[model samples]
Target: MRFDIITLFPEMFAPFLASGVTRRAYASDQVAVRLWNPRDYAQGNYRRVDDRPFGGGPGMVMLVEPLQACLDAIRADRAEDPATQVPLVLFSPIGKTLDHPAVEQWAQSPGAVLLCGRYEGIDQRFIDTHVDAQISLGDFVLSGGEIAALALLDAVTRLQPGVLNDAGSHQLDSFNPSLDGLLDCPHYTRPEVWQGQEVPPVLMSGHHAQIERWRRDQSLQITARHRPELLAKARAAGRLDRKDEAVLAKIADGL
Candidate 1:
């Protein structure tokens, strides 16, 4: 997968792309990430990418001409024609909220162009003409979109098939279908006892079926306590079978 980010502060993405598992993915050629700075496209002596808004806003809005030039150059390099399917996204507070399902969908796309608006934001005309979607990380306000863009990239990159040594690792994340969209069950390491808490005996019993049952039960309990909405949504979707209902019932009983 390829990710091209358009931003004035492209340096902000350096840490995530050069460190941790995502960096390993890049090193293994499992994914590609590139940053494009709009300022590079600016013409004239100042090479300014922002200007005072016509209506006079508190912060300068990113100028559209430079952004359009940058994006056009990027598309040209990729051999993308005018008729190509578009998936360029602009990060904005007013856009649709992003979630695990959204990340999954993006991971399946051939590639993406992420526009990280700065200062007050990008020019509205640029977004109207080029953006295919506007996505928000959540219902919070931030100074700029750089952080959100990194979060999005990390979420999708980890889903690539060879990104993780254990393919099943990403598969068992909180929203995975195998876990019925419940939060993951507790995980224990080598220590039989930690601090004062003992590893659940069922995990050490070497009984796969019993361990599976215990995990399912623990998942139900965790979801019921921390995210009942997930269970409710699962029930509403009619994805909960009798066994699932039984597990949830036991969870509710204990609560």
Candidate 2:
């Protein structure tokens, strides 16, 4: 898969591509990432890409012409590949909040054109005409969409085969269907005792069934305490079985 990102600060992505476990995906071209600077397409002595808003806004609005030109160049570059039907995604607060499912979809996709907006925002006209979808990290705002773009890239890249040291690691990740959309249970490392606290006895028992049961119960308790809505959603989707319900009921009774 290929990801073409349009950003004013392409330099910001340098360390990202070169560092981390996910770098394997980028290094092997399993998930090719190309950075495009909109300023390169801007027409001016200074190559400006933003201007004062028409309605007299507090911050400048990104210009459409430079963005359009950049997209045109990108499209022409990808025109050789008939199978490259990429979505133009813009990161914005108004867009759907990105989630595990969305990450999974991108992991399986051919690629996309990620537009990282600056200033107040991208021109609405450009968005209406060119953008295919919009995604948000959360309710909060950022100085630019570069961080969100990086988040998407990191999430998707980690899911690529061979990117992670363990092939099935992501399957056990929090919010995965394998865990019925529950947050993962607490993890323990080599030391059985830490800070004078012994490792949970079940983890040391070496009984596979008992270990699995303990993990599941911990996951259920953690999720119910921190994100009850997710547990409710799992129940609504029929993911929680009788045994799971019984455990949760015991937790509710403070057992």
Candidate 3:
């Protein structure tokens, strides 16, 4: 997969693309990333990209000309094809919140072009003409889209094939269906015994099937104690299988 990131601050992406699972993914040729600076498309001595709002607003609005030119150049390079669509996303607080499902969808796509808006925001005309979607990290706003871009890229790229060292690692993450939409059960290390507490007896047992059952039970138990809303959603979506229901039943009984 390939990701083209359009931003005013291309330098911000260097550390992100060079470390962790994303870096490994890029090194293995499982993924590709390129950054484009909108300022490069700007004309004049200052190479200015933003301008004061026409009617006068608090912060300067991003100029459409430079952004449009930059996007056009990108399309030209890719030789845009309708059948093989690539999503062009603009990060903004007004858009749909970024979540697991959205990340999953992006991981399956051929690639995406992300617009990292700065200053006040990009002109609506440029966004309307080129952007395929607008994604928000959460309800809060950020100074610029650079941080959000890095976040989204990291999140989606880690889910791509070969990105994870262990196949089952990300699968077991909270919100993943493998745990029936519950947060993962607690993890343990070689010590077996902690500061004062010993590992659960079930974990120390040599019964693989029973260990798996215990993990599932603990997942549901922890979810019920900390985030019953997650279990409720899973139930509504029919994500909880019969075995998961059994685990929940046992958890409830103990409570």
User: Over 4 Å off in model 2, which ranges?
Assistant: 80-84
Best by lDDT: 2
**Model 2 residue 25 lDDT score:** 85
Those runs of model 1 whose alpha carbons end farther than 4 Å from true positions after fitting are none
Q: 37-81, model 3: which lDDT tens digit per residue?
A: 988999999988998988986999999989988888887887888
lDDT of 1 by residue, 53-141 (tens): 88775888899999999998889777776787447998999999988889889889877898998888888888888899999988999
TM-scores for all predictions: 0.94, 0.97, 0.91
Ranking by lDDT: 2, 1, 3
How accurate locally is residue 103 in candidate 1, as Cα lDDT from 0 to 100? 89
lDDT of each: 0.86, 0.94, 0.85
Q: How far off is residue 142 in model 3, in Å?
A: 1.2
State the lDDT of candidate 2 residue by residue for 1-255, as single tens digits.
999999999999999999999888898899999999999999979999999999785999999999999999998988846364799999999999999999999999998999999999988999999899999999999999999999999999999988999999999999999999999999887788888988899988999999999999999999999999999999999999999999999999983
Order of quality (TM-score) = 2, 1, 3
Candidate 1: RMSD over Cα atoms? 1.5
